[model samples]
Target chain A: MKSLSLKRLLVTSALLLWSLTSLASSQFTGPSRDANGNVVPTPKGEQCVEPTADMRANHMKYLLHKRDLTMYDGIRTKQHSIVACIDCHATPNEDGKIVRIHDDSNQHFCASCHAVASVKLDCFECHADRPVEAFSDADYDPVQQLDEALAHSDKPHALMNRKVQ
Target chain B: MSHLDQETDMKNTAKSSAPNKIDQYRRRFLGGSVAAVAGVAIAPGVFLQTVNAKPADQEVTANNRWGLLIDTTKCASGCSDCVSACNKEHGLREIHGPETDAQWIRKVTLKNKSTGHTINLPMMCQHCEKPPCVDVCPTGASFRRVDGIVLVDKHICIGCRYCMMACPYKARSFIHETLTDQLPHAPRGKGTVESCTLCVHKVDRGDGNTACAEACSHGAILFGDLNDRSSEISRRLATTGGRELRAELGLNLGVRYQGL
Candidate 1:
C-alpha cells in the first residue's frame, strides 16, 4: 500500500509540473508571424535584418540623410578619408569595441544618420573628416598620471634581477 | 474524525517501519533545496539598491562625487524632449535649420550587431576628473571649475581644437562657417570650439540647472554634485546600475552616459 501511494504521488507531481510549464509557455508566446515579419534563424546563421515596412522605411530615411558621404556642402576640411562611414559605425571590427565617440571614422550613429538625411548638419562640416573635438576633463592630477602610467606599464618590468655579465 | 482518531491512536497502530534511509535522504534534499531557493529569491531584492531608500536629497561623500545614473532599461525610444529642451534653452530651434548652433548635447542610436538590439544613448561630455583637453592645452585656459564643470574662457580660446582631439566623446564642435551657418536662432561667433557647458552660464546665476536634465522627459539626464549624497545626481548614481564609459581610463569624468 505504501509503495502504491508513493507511485501515485510521483505521477501526480509530474503531471502537475508538466501542466504548469505548458500553461506558462503558451501564455508567453504570442501569435507567431511570417518569415519577413520577425527575425528568423537562417541556416547561414541567426540573421538580423530590419524586418517591417516601417522599419525599412525608417532605416532608409536614416541612410539617406546620414549617409557618410564625406565631401558634401559643408566639409571644412580640404582632405577626406575615402573609407565609408558604414565601415566603422555599422559593425565593430576585431577589437570588439565601438568606435570611440571621438573617432572621425564612426559615421554610423543615428544622429549622424539623421544628419545625412537632413540638410546641413552643422557640426559635421567642422568635424566629419577631423578628429572628435570635445570639452577638456577638469579633474586630472599630474601626480596620479605618472603613477598610473608606471602601474599600467608591463608589470613593473617584472622586477628584473640583472646579472652583470 | 476517523483520520483524527487514527492519528491519536498512534500508540496502538504505530507500526515501527525500518528507518527509510533513502526516503529520509530525499526528504532532506528537498528541504535543503526549498531553503536555498527561498534565500536566492529574497536576498537580492533586499540587498540590492536598498541603501538608496533614503530621501532623494541625502548627502554623498568622496568616491561619492557627482555622477549620473542613466538607467538604460528605463529609457524609452523616439523621445526627444532632452534635445528640444537643449535647443530651446540654447535657442537652436527658433532659427531652426541644421545650423541650430548649440548642439552641446545630442542623442545617438546604435545597433549591436551581435544581439540585433537597438539602443539609444544620449551623449554628453564626461568632464573627466583629469580632462584630456586640460592636459593637452598649451594655454592652460581650459580649466576645470571647482564644482567640476569644464569650460573655455572666451577671453583665452584660440580655437586650435587640440582639446577636441583629446576628447573621446566627440562632444566638441568648432564654430565653423559662422558667417553662413550661425542660425538666426542662436548665433555663435566663429573661432571658438564649444560643447555642452552643462549650462554653467545659467547655473552661475543659480537660476537654471543643466538645461538638458531639466528637459529630459524620461529622466535620462541628471545633474548634481556627486560629493553631496542628497543631490539628485548623487542619489541616482548610488542606487542605479550606472557604469562609466572607458572607466579603465581612470579619467574620472564628471558626466555619465545613460541607457546604452
Candidate 2:
C-alpha cells in the first residue's frame, strides 16, 4: 500500500513538472519564429529609439501619441511615424516580395506581434499596410534608406541610437 | 478736527486710494506680461514649450479659412482633369458602376431652359459653414474643422447615408466594395461615407494647394486663404463677386463660382 501511494505521488510530481516546463517554453517563445517552425529574420535597425523592453511594453502608447501629433500638428517626423514602422518591419514573402500587414499567408511585424497578443488592429482596414509602391525600387535595403532619408530631411533626427526629441 | 470731520477725512482718503489700488493692480499685470515676453524672447525655447504643452491638439486653425474660387468661364466643357486629379489623389477607383462607385468631385453641365445657354463646371463638396450633412449626423461623425473645412470621420461613421441625403450638392459617396491599393494619405473603407476633403492630407502637409486647383490647366480653380483679405481668392471674389450655388440657402459655401 505504502509503495503504491509513493508511486502515485512521484507520478503526480512528474506530471506537474512537465506541464510547468511546457508552459514556460511556450510563454518564452521568440517572435522571430513563425507558427510553422520557420525562423523569420529579425528586422534590422541600428537600435530602436527606445530600448527593446521599453518598446515591447509601450509601443502602442508611443504610436498613439505620435499619430495625434502627425494628424493634428502636421508633424511628420520619422521618429514615430507608422509609415516608418512599416518601412522598417516589412518582411519578404516566398517570392522575395515584400508582404503587407494584412497578408494571411505571411505575417508582417505588426501582424505578428498583434497575433501573438491577440489584439485587433483596425489600421490596415483603411490605411495601407505595406510601404507604398513608390518605395518599391529601394525595397532591397529600405530601412537604411528610410533612416537616411529621414535623417537628411528638413526635420532631421539626431542620429541612429539617439533619443528622439 | 472734531470726530465727524475726522470720519469725513477718512472717507475721502478711502475714495482717493481706490483708484491708486486699481492702478497698482494694472501695473503688476503689465509688468508680469512684459517679463513673460522678455523671457520668451531670451530663451525662445520657453515659447516652444508652451506650444507643446497646449492641451488641445488642433492641427487646423480658423486663422486661415481655405476656399476655392472656380471661374466656370475658363473651364473647358469636355475637360475632366480636376475630377481625374481628385480621383487619383483620393484613390477613388471605380470597382462598381457609376451608380455605386464613389465620386469625390464631378463635372456638371447645366443649361438655361429659356436662353439655351449652357455652362460646364465642376461640382464638389461646397464645404459649407452651415453644412446640412453635419446637422443631420446622428453619430456626430460629420464635423467641420476649426479652419472651416468639413470632413466625415469615417472611423465612427455608421454608413447610415443620412449625410448623403442631407447634402444639397450630392457630394458624399458611400463605398460599396472592399478597396485595395488605397493611397497611404487617404484611407477609404467599405460602408463609410467619403467626400472631397479639399486634399486635406496635402493641405495639412503645408502644401497650401489642392489637387483640383493644381490640375486645372485652364486656371479655372483658384485656391487660397479666404480669411486673408489680401489673398488671391479674396481679391478675385472682391472683383467678380462670385455667386454661391443655392445662395438663398445661406450656407456660405467655401467654394464660389464666378461664371455660374
Candidate 3:
C-alpha cells in the first residue's frame, strides 16, 4: 500500500512540472503573430520604454514593487501584468531611441494602436512621461534601492510614507 | 576692522567653532530626519545641511522664479484636454493608475469618504523652495534651476530613491526600460526619477508653453513668468487665495492650489 502511495505522488509531481514548462513556452509565442502563423520577433517595436539612467534606476525599484503585479496573462492568477511599456515611453533618443546623447518625452508606442483604433489617447493618465532632469531624486540605481527597501522593511529600520526635510 | 585682521579673526572663529549653529542643528535634524523617516517626529526649526562649497549657479530665482498656478475652481472634472494634449505632446505608454506610471501631470478624483463630496484636481510637482528631494538625493543629482525649475541631471543619477522618500507630494517616478526614438520630445532613458518642470525646454523656447497648461479647456492651468507683474500667474497671486501644500514647512513652493 505504501509503495502504491509513493507511486501516485511521484506521478502527480511529474505532471505539474510538465505543465509549468509548457505554459512558460507558450507565453512568448502569442501577442506576436505574423501574417502566416509565424512568430513576430519584434513585438516591442523599434522603440522601447525610455527612462534616463537615473529614472530608469528608480523605475527598476518601482518595478520591483510591481514585480508580483506584472503578470499580464489573463488566464493565470500568477501571470504578470506590467510589460515592456516603460521602455521607449518616457525618454526617447533623438531618432526616438533612448541613449546618452538624446532624450525626449514627446515619443511613444501608443500611436501605433491608437491610430488603428482611431482612439484619441490621454497620455498623462498613464505616464508621468517627463524628462530625466525634472526630479530631485532621479539619480539612484533601483537595484541598489531594493537593498534599501529591504533594509527599511526590517525591524527598527522601516519607513512608510515618511517625511524628509 | 582692517581686511587682513578681519579675515584672520574669521578664520580663528571658524577653527574654534565645530560647525555653524545651523550646521550643528542640521546634523541633529538630519539624525532626526532618519527618525522622522522612520515615522518619528522631529523637533521644530531643524533643516537640512547646505551642500558644502556648492556653486551658487544652481540657485533658483537668483536666476529665475519658475512657478505654476492651477485654478481648481475652474476645473471641469469631466474634461481631459490636458491629459490628451500631454499624450500628444509627449508620447507615452498605456495609461496607469496614480500609484504607478511616471506621469508628470494627472487628474485625481477625490471623494470625501465622510462628506460624500467629490473633487477632481490636476496634480504635479510642487517645486518647493525647501525641496526635501534635494536634501535626500545622495548624489545631488536632483536640483533646482536658478529659474526655480526643479530638475534631475540624468547623467549623474544612480537611481536611489532617497529623493522619492523625501518628496511629500508623491510627485516622482523612476524609469524602468530602454526606449525607441520616434518623437524628439519624448524623454526616454533608463534609471532616473522624473516629474513636471513646468515645461522648461518648451517655455524657454517661448513656444511650447506647458502642454497641460495650454490644453486645459476650462482654463484650469495658467502658466507665466511669476516675476512679471503683468503675468497671469502674478495676477492670480494678487487676487486668489491659493494656498501651498504643507505651507507651514516654509518651502516657498512655486505651485499654488485654489479650491473651486
Candidate 4:
C-alpha cells in the first residue's frame, strides 16, 4: 500500500512538471511580427549565417567569442558580429519605428527574448542598438558641414568661394 | 648466397632502387610546382586587396606599427578641427566641463616663457611602447596592441583609475555618467577608462588614416605605418625628424611631434 502511494505521488509530480514546462513554453512568443504579418527581414543576406536552432542556442557564445577576437585581436569578421545581428534583427515596426534595445515592448529583437528570460542586457548602453544608416545624414546640417569644411580646409578662401557658387 | 653473389644482388637492388627514387622525387617536384603555381595565382588578388586594409579574419600583427607625425608649426592656434573630428568620430559629447568631460584629443597651446613664442598642437594618448598605464593596471585591462595601438579593454577594466594615475600625458579619462548611442566602433560606458583609439576602426577598414589627420586641412597630421620604411610618416621622420613628448621617460611613443 505504501509503494502504491509512492507511485501515485511520482505520477502526480511528473504530470505537474510536464504542465509547468508547457505553460512556460506557451508564454514565450519568440520573434514578433509586424501589422502586415511580415517577419524580420534579413537585409544583407538571404538568411542568418548559422542555422536557426544553432543560433538560438549558441548566439551568445558566438558573440562573446567574436567580441574577444575583435577587442583583443582586431579580427572584425561579419560572420558572428553584433553589428550584423543588429542590422538584420532590429527591424522596424508597423509604424516604421525601430524599437530601442531597452524598450518595454517585445518589438526589439534582442530585448524581446531577454525580457522573457529575465536577462538584463547592458550592451545597448555602450554599443549602438540601431544600424549605422538608421541615423540619417538628413540631421547633419549643411551649414555645419560647410563650416567644418572651411575650418579644416587648407585653402579656406577657395572652399568658401566654391560653396558660395 | 656466396659473398660475390650477395654483392651482385646488392648492386642489382641499388641500380633498380635509384630509378624508383628519382621517379618519386620527380613526381613530388611536379606536385609541388603545381601547388605553388596555384597558390601564386590565387594569393596575389587576396594580398593586393588587403594591401592597405587588413582582412576581417586577420589579426593585427607587430609587422605594422601605426603612428602619427604632427607638425606643430602647421597646427593653427585656436583651430580645434582635430578635436571636433575626434569627438564626432567617437561620439564623445561635452556633457560636463573640461575637468569632467572626456577629451580623447585636445588642442594644447604651449608658450615659451623666455621667448614668448607659442605653439599649438593636438595632444592625445601617446600609444607608448612600454605604457605606464599597462604596467600599473592590476586587471591587465590597459594593454597595447601588437600593432602599437594602446587600448583599454573595458570588459576587464575594474574602474580602478590606476592607469589614469600612472599615465604621464594624462591621456586616459574615466566616464562619470552613463553614455548612450556610442559609435559601433567605439563602445564606451560609464565606470571605464577610455582614450584615443587612434581611429582603429578606420585602420582596420584599410582607410589608413585617422579622423583627426583626415580632418586637418593644413596637412599637419600624417598617419602611416612607422615600421614601413616607404610610409610617409617614416620618411618624414627620417629626413626632418620628430620628438616624443616627455622623451626622458623613455616610453617610445608612437605619436611624435615636429617643431615642438
Most TM-score-accurate candidate: 4
lDDT of each: 0.48, 0.70, 0.53, 0.76
Error of 2 at A91 (Å): 4.5
Error of 4 at B222 (Å): 0.7
Report the C-alpha lDDT of model 2 over A1-165, residue by residue, as the tens digit. 879767645644454454344345556676445444433435657787666544544465567666645543445667767777666666565456776666774367676555544567887778777765444433223234446656677864423333211
Residue A78 local lDDT, model 1: 17
lDDT of 1 by residue, A84-154 (tens): 32222333323533333234433334233233233233433323221112111211222233345457777
* Model 1 chain B: ten consecutive residues of lowest lDDT: B55-64
Per-prediction TM-score to the true structure, in the order listed: 0.43, 0.69, 0.47, 0.74
**Against the true structure, whose lDDT is highest?**
4
CAPRI-style class, candidate 2: incorrect
lDDT of 1 by residue, B138-240 (tens): 7765756544666665335688989889988877766654432222112345687777766653443343367767767777666666665567776677676
Q: Tell me the spans in candidate 4 whose CA falls farther than 4 Å from its real position.
A: A1-45, A138-165, B1-50
- Residue-level lDDT tens digits of model 3 in A1-165: 879757644543453453355346557674332222322123234633332322212233334333312111001111111233433233443344432221122224333223323346433333333334322231222223335655766553323332221
Q: Per candidate, chain B TM-score?
A: 0.65, 0.78, 0.71, 0.81
Q: For model 3, what is the alpha-carbon lDDT of residue B155?
A: 44
For candidate 2, report its TM-score: 0.69
Lowest summed lDDT over 10 consecutive residues: which window, candidate 1 chain A?
Answer: A69-78
Interface C-alpha root-mean-square deviation of candidate 1: 30.7
